[model samples]
Target: MLGGIIEFLLLKQSLPIGLSLLISATVVSLIAVLIHRLFIAKTKNATELSLIIMTIGISITIRGIVGILVDKNAHPVKPFLSFSSVSLFNLVFSSQYVIVIFSTLVLAFLLYFYLKKTLSGKIMQAVSMNSLAARLFGIDVGLVQMSSFAISGFIGALAGAVIAPISFVQYDMGIMFGLKGFAACVVGGFGNNNGALIGGLIIGVAESLSAGYISSSYKDLIAFLIMILVLFVKPSGLFASKDVERI
Candidate 1:
């Protein structure tokens, strides 16, 4: 939603690219926080289920609003980074892809360090493990959840900003990306950051191989097939350990 609006502002209204992105990020963040406070925090039963339903509704609403505002057309975005392609051995790659790789690696390292070493990150981990226990220990679980949501929103906005230049910005552009991300989580281990990273890499490779060998149309099918096969073979996920709780 923000991506579409940002593209519109940048291309249609001739707004400065940086300013457009900043404005979209700010507006989206505020709206997300408001939604979380008003509806998500007020849910009384099955919070996760409620959140999923609310998310679907919000996604549909955003798509509709973006379509109405920007029309159901794709908008091209100017490349944020451009460089000559480089060849190493027999392989050739664009500088944009290299930047993406480096940025991903840096972000992953920072996230790992933060989660493992920082006080707030540890607190967030504790909340994830057992919110009731964290609450009993004087940690505000609601605050932790809110902070997590904010951080997630920030990361998502950054990703959109980075990828918008490479891909056409459209009202429904996120649907496939979001589904693939969900598949990655399932393939790895849900709630496991390391697993998510590994899962995403595996999916990327799989999709590429499928498109090369099978067909472009089968790329998505292959991804979901991998996900389904993993679930059937080991529902705990490839990286997840089975846990047995004592009664």
Candidate 2:
């Protein structure tokens, strides 16, 4: 919405996408902070009722607004090139698959370096590793948490944008994307970015295979089954942090 509004008003692309991404990140993180401050942090109880109620309200509000905006319409995007397959070792790969795999690897390395080499990244890890110690070192824990959430939001938005170019994105599309992304996070092990990436890829590949071999309608069920199997065999995650000690 911001990007579209900017391009219409400014008649330029120079600042539209970047500025939209920034604002989206800010807004997303601000909402997250509001929920934390209003419900989670303020509550004496640990049952999460406040948080749940707030989120339920948010969900209905979003859906109601989106439902009003959408019509019974469908459109599709046409790729610029002809369909062709590339042979990679034993498996045959399509252009889209190749792009997805390459981008995933690049994103993985970029995130790894971002977390390891950057000062903010160090602070983020420190805050998650030991928040009390991090605070004692003069780091603003609240600010760090907000920044971390902002980064997560930015990534999520970018991923949505990428998918939108290929797949039709409606206002309500976030539901399925968020679910899959959350599943990936769980598969990756919460608080571990590397794990998230691995988990996402694993889920993607599993879904692809299952859809190819089994009924397409059962892909979701198969993905959940895979998740259950992984948890049973590797409780933390198949690609959980190496430093994590098993109980």
Question: How many clashes in each structure?
Answer: 0, 1
Candidate 2 residue-wise lDDT, 15-48, digit = tens: 4544544554455556556655665456575464
Q: Which regions of candidate 1 fall more than 4 Å away from where they truly are?
A: 4-27, 241-247
Model 2, runs deviating above 4 Å: 1-60, 69-103, 242-247
Best by lDDT: 1
The alpha-carbon lDDT assigned to residue 99 of candidate 1 equals 59
Q: What is the TM-score of each candidate against the true structure?
A: 0.87, 0.69
lDDT of 1 by residue, 126-148 (tens): 99888999999999888888777
lDDT for 172 in candidate 2 is: 62
